[model samples]
Target: MQQIFDFKALVKYRDRAAQRLGTVTPVLEELTDRLLDRLDDTTSRFSTALDFGGRGVLAPMLKARGISVDSADFSALLAAKAGGTPLPLPGPADFKLTQARYDLIVAPLSLHGLDDLPGALIQFRRALKPEGLLLASLPVLGTLHELRLNLLETEETLTGKVSPRISPFPELRDCAGLLQRAGFTHPVADIEELEFLYANPLALLHELRDAGEGNALCARSRAIPPRALFPAALAAMPRKEGRMVARLRMAVLTGWAS
Candidate 1:
């Protein structure tokens, strides 16, 4: 697959966050809760599951339902923190899984950073037992738009050069199409718009780093940016009720393994 995100960087950031972050990011916790809630709508009882990218939220929930779960993440520490044996990512876009092994696979707010998202989806589908369920969510097009725009404008004003700061995310309309392309049955996709608030722009940045959601685009420059860049850019975001607001357009996706 063509390069997109730096997978190793992603792992490092996640592991660091696992070591240092004291609490869960509200957005992550909310998304995890929302994804698990989808399980309630399904009549089929799942016996086994894979908790991909859960931040100490999903494994407990699935176990509570008496479903045995295996947790996997690029970061081993992250998987351990999620309360399951760590299944590490073998490569940027490739991993081996036993075919027809799981009753359910829940990959929330993950997969978007992958260089080969379609390939990863196909693997997830292949790992499911017959009629198994795949429920996932990812940051779609409007996510982080406020911060992205402000950063771009800030960089342009100071350096007169454009840089790829924010990673590209999938679009909502095409999410279902992705599932179809990966050969999933009964594919469906929908959007959930969420808003979060922070005290200031720096607080927003801090939360992002603490959540291990820092920029991992392969095209991102390694050189240190202007000292004033972040301060100026984040300060420019529009505030609501005296708090800086961040919007997340999440594409909640579902499919069945045939």
Candidate 2:
């Protein structure tokens, strides 16, 4: 299969950023809380849980709630920081399952970057005990639409062509289908739209970098984008109360293992 993301590079960058930035993704933190709240409302309690791709946020939260949580992350640095295990990138074969099965598995703000999301979901299902719950939040279609459009327009105008700058995200409409295809039962998907205000476009770009969400597209441009593009994109953002606003949409998915 053709590669869509440079996942290895992504892991490296994220690990380094974690070491330097010291766990700064408030969005992930908020999403983790939301997932836990959902679990609380639906189920009484989970005895054992796995925090997948949380990088460090969900494990502590689960433990605080009296759940036995084991954390796993794609970045070695992040894993070390979280005092958890490291997960290898998804490949043709499924990940090796642990001897102990989990009652719940939660992945927050992480699944969207996977090249083989279906395969990962299958692995998640197999790793869980029967009827165990899976909850995941991923940035879906329409995430950063403003930034994507601005980049496209500015790059095209400056270079006479455009290259992929933002990674493609899964559509909310397709989330349930993917879960079903992965053999997950009782799949449910919902979307949450969020808007953030930044002082300028450079602030937005800096936030993305600090969050380890910089461009990771395999087909992304090798040459540096024109400096003018940044200001142009910033200027193009919708201004509300004199602050530039960017939009993001997150798809939260839930399923049960049979």
Candidate 3:
């Protein structure tokens, strides 16, 4: 893949909000359990661990297991607090990691945030041993379908635009193919759908912000969203009996180094 243009927003975004990073752990841990269950053996020579998107939660878990985990995050603040070394690049680094060299890497619900996903996958593949495993969970194409639909509806109603601020996530088949292309073997991918009920659209938005999750539109400026867009956006949401609902599709991929 061609190199991505230099862009660095998530670093500052995540750095100042490390505390909110733990909110997604319930969803991530669910996927993590499935990945671990599928592993051939937990006691195998997988002595070292790497948490690629590790900010607050996964880092602690790996440490508790007595494994030396090299935590990587865009947030320098998070890396410092978690006792991790920061990744040198914004999206993907071509160098190998020597901070306790990892045999298993866990990146949950974060791959879509990259600018050069294919290149990043290759980097992760190279960071592992021949028998090492990568347990990755990502928000795929169908993720947040309800939210996307709502955004489209709101766009049409308010601005006559039918698109959203966030990019569409990678399709499941495409993700598996990308992993294979990145040189992983026995690649397996699966999906788990999560439905969250909210009292209102504002509540849902608050939750997302509180969790430090937001649109990753790289080209968008730092200006605040217009006030008029708020209500229209909320009105476009899926409401049943005065309650709004959102669906999150989480995809998990497991592969071994070739």
Candidate 4:
């Protein structure tokens, strides 16, 4: 019901990421592989799939398995470039697809930004055939928590005020509940926590930018932050083996349409 994201900004950042990424984002590839690995755990056979918010990674793998794939994203450019269809991101109420059209729908690392995640999930469920599956990967609470904490502490220490700098993510326990609320059957949610050694904290920031993980919160601070904010924050990060350790927690959600 509340619009928390700036869709225009989301699309702009996504397009920039799409152009810059060009199918070579290690993080995206990692998540896609993980999602597919879960797919292998199932015995269901799918002839068609919709790769939602795909970055040109998941569809190819599915195609190789003889499954027809259609791609969609919040960015039309990305939707076309990745999946060959120029579908724009749909609002919760506006997401329309042929009923019972696809046997599988895969959404990777894209659900966290939606203002109406439950509504979107319902729409996704509606577009699937009976007994079809919906699989999605999204960042959960505590993902990038260290960075968020450091940034907030540094900013508050410097300016005595704080505004949202990082986006909020869904909690792990609530993911499956969302599916159930959307009328999914046998909904399940699990998580994988991955730690990466970054050359430095700045490298993490750069990768996020390159990945188009920019802040799109409608309430985000528009004014440029203090010049020393990032430096101060990054300097405060914990180190592991002389490198900055960044932890990413991705939640995998699964449900059957029927």
Candidate 5:
């Protein structure tokens, strides 16, 4: 399969950022909290849980809830930060999940980067015990739409062509289908749209960088974008209350391992 993302580079970038900043993305943290809240409402008690690609957020929360939690991530630095076992989980093709190891598996803001999402979902299903729960939060298709549009229009106006500047995310219905394809029962996918205000477009870009959410597409432009591109894009962005606004639509998916 063709590699769509520079997964290793992503891991290295995230690790370095974590080492330097020691901060979590605000939106991601919020999303994780929401997912955990849903888990809390569940009547089923999970004895063993896997915080898959959660960057350590879910594990400690699960532990606090008296569930035995283990975490896995592609970035060793992130894993260490989360106090988890380091696992180089680049994609579904590299998955080596042990059968029926977890009663609950949760992945927060991680599945959108996978090259083989369906395969990953299948692996999650296989790794879970019967009636086990699977929950995942992924950026939906409309995430960063404004940024994508502004960048594309700016590039097209300047260079007469556009380059890939954002990662393509899955749609909500597609996520539901993936869960069903993975043989999970009672699949559910819901969207949560979040709007954030930034001082300027540069701030928004910086936030994405700080969150380790840079462009990782194989087809992404290697050359630096023109200096005027950003300013122009910023000027073009819609302002609300004197601040630039960015929107992110996150898809939360849940299912039961049958």
Candidate 6:
């Protein structure tokens, strides 16, 4: 996709980081708790679940709830590192979905990485049973708007090339529409905006790298030549209250089979 920046290596990097972190952030942990809180425990037969971005955090929760979860990821590295089923992204949902035979599916910050997000959602819907539930949390539109704006301004003024260094996340409306278009019933979506204060751009970049949220769009160029453009672009960004604030927008989406 045109919006993808350094897609291949970036995904690989994320997989590695996931292996290292082995724990979910407070934000994601909270989201997972909410999703789990909404789970219907009336049916003990439907105890099998699937974790799409399961780096290892939700495993304990699912186990505690007596639910067996099949953790999956497109990254062979992540899957192997995390020691679970390794699956391809957005292909052959029937095969994987059947293999797992899950009644609940959870994807935390995983859907946005797909190039064909709409198609992937369709696959997720197909993977579910009539009474199955699908839950996903992804960064949507308005995410990192400040960083994007600053990068654009910097590129325009320095290199005259606005290299979008981030993935194109879908908006909350688009995400809900995608669930419906993919044939999900009772689709619900909520937008959550998080503002993180950074000491500077370098610090922000470091956090992004550690979080594995750095650029991964394949269409993007990853070359950085040693020239005045680099410094000039960095200088173009503005400081806010003596610090830089980057705003991130994430959407929590849930749906059920019809």
Tens digits of per-residue lDDT for model 6 on 99-121? 22667787877677666677677
Residue 32 in model 4: lDDT: 90
- Give the whole-model CA lDDT for all candidates, comma-separated: 0.85, 0.78, 0.67, 0.85, 0.80, 0.66
lDDT of 2: 0.78
Candidates in order, TM-scores: namely 0.96, 0.92, 0.83, 0.96, 0.93, 0.80
Return the TM-score for candidate 3, rounded to 2 decimals: 0.83
Q: Between which residue pairs do clashes occur in model 5?
A: none
Deviation from truth (RMSD, Å), model 1: 1.3
Off by over 4 Å in 6: 1-7, 22-31, 34-46, 81-95, 225-243
Model 6: how far is 228 from its true place, Å? 7.5
The list of candidate 1 runs beyond 4 A from truth reads none
Order of quality (lDDT):
4, 1, 5, 2, 3, 6
Looking at model 4, residue 117 earns an lDDT score of 90
Residue 255 accuracy (lDDT) in model 2: 92
Per-residue CA lDDT of model 2 for 102-198, tens digit only, reads 9898888877667888988888888888888989988888988887898899988998999988888888999999999988999999888888887
Clashing pairs in 1: none
Model 5: how large is the Cα RMSD against the reference? 1.8
Tens-digit lDDT string for candidate 1 (1-258): 578888889888888888755655555767788877888888899999998888777777788889998889888888878876567667755677778989899998878778888888999999999899999999899899978898889899998986888889888999999999999988999888888887866877777788788889888988899999998887888789998888888888999999
Alpha-carbon RMSD, each predicted model: 1.3, 2.0, 3.3, 1.4, 1.8, 3.7
Candidate 5: list runs displaced more than 4 Å.
Answer: 90-92
The C-alpha local distance difference test score for the whole of candidate 4 amounts to 0.85
Considering every candidate listed, which one attains the maximal lDDT?
Answer: 4
lDDT of 4 by residue, 1-258 (tens): 788988778878888988777534666787799988988898999998998888878788788888988887877778887753446666535667778999999998888778989888988998999999999999999898988999999999999999888899889999999999999999999999998787767888878877778999999999999999998998887789988888889999999998
* Backbone clashes under 3 angstroms, per model: 0, 0, 0, 0, 0, 7
TM-score of 1: 0.96
